[model samples]
Target: MSYVFQFGPILDRWPLFLHGALLTIELAAISTFVGLAIAVVLAVSRSFGPRPVAWLIGAYVELIRNTPLLVQLYLVYFVLPKAGMRLDSNQAAALALSANLAAYATEIIRAGLEATPRGLVEAGLSLGLRKGRIIRHIILGPALRSVYPALGSQFVLQILGSSLVSAIAAEELTAVSNNIMMETFRNFEVFIVTGALYLAMVLAFRVFFAQTNRSLFRWAA
Candidate 1:
């Protein structure tokens, strides 16, 4: 049982691995941004919109939350082409991941909204604040601050989940690892390095979020 270990080949392809890692970060960034936008819309609507609209949004949340993400990716991968909305692998992955993230993010944001006391709105009204300004400055800001940790954690999950886009040949970190494994026949080493890269990225993102949380919510602190 003497299996020789060699990382020289894997190390030699540093450029490939670096490219893949950057692409993975790119995918995560795209999905998180677009998903947060969608989540904000859905959350505000769910929290304050009419009953029928809330119900529809609730249905979407349930459907996306209950299903496997791979299935959702497959649906986007196959369905759009037939509908004449052509998108490449990366675009499709970004769209699918964004939708998936939005569902969970909507719930996170709505919970923050719910935790806000009704008296805050009343207080804003008493202070001569218009409804729009109250919602923006008085309500949403605090609510978003309350939920920033959860949202940041969700983005980390998004980064990890970007690995699945390899299923559609999106050429992200995991996809590149697979290619390296094939070329070097070093599945174990390839994954170990890829996992390390992912860990480093996640830790870096957590630090960034921490600093941002301090800067953005210093008033609350």
Candidate 2:
């Protein structure tokens, strides 16, 4: 007997897949932007702040970077309850994803910040620009442009990693696929569809990031 391929069952439940795809996008978008914001702050603090602040931020970056993301997800969803703080699966997923991405983004942005030339900074100061103004107007643009490609790669990884949130019952793409597979017993078809959705999402993110890089950095040159 030969195995028969069937997609009819999977196709009938397109709505569920659509919902999962949207949820995946939502989770990735929110976490990536929030993570980037937190990463910028951490990088700036580590780069320019006092010694103690820098050390604390450094420790956080190391801790998150060294540990596994799954462990972090478990810690947020399972461990926090013992400390009297409880979060739902989706909330925990978002928190873990943001923190995870921030650790890596912090280092990427910090490298860009470090690569900034000292002469420009001095020139900005001589022109009476405030410290914050100098960073915002003079340093930030170039630094971001320098690291934008790395950041884009990280964002795509984050979007793919969102699939792991299903382990916490977050109802993301993977979780939704599991449900469909159980219902239809079309494991191959279901996973193939799920994988395609993830690929499409990653491609979309790449395009979005590319456009952003062009538009934001066009004036920097």
What is candidate 2's lDDT per residue for 134-221, written digit by digit as tens? 9889888789889998999898998788999988899688999999999998899999999998899889889988998889788865
Where model 2 places Cα greater than 4 Å from the true spot, the runs are 127-130
lDDT measured at residue 130 in model 2 versus the true structure, 0 to 100: 94
- The CA lDDT at 113 in model 2 is 94
The candidate maximizing TM-score is 1
* Reference-based TM-score of each model: 0.95, 0.93
**Where does candidate 1 clash, by residue pair?**
none
TM-score of 2: 0.93
lDDT of each: 0.93, 0.91
Off by over 4 Å in 1: 126-130
For model 2, state the Cα shift of residue 109 in Å. Answer: 1.2
Alpha carbon RMSD to native, model 2: 1.7
> Residue 31 of candidate 1: its Cα lDDT?
96
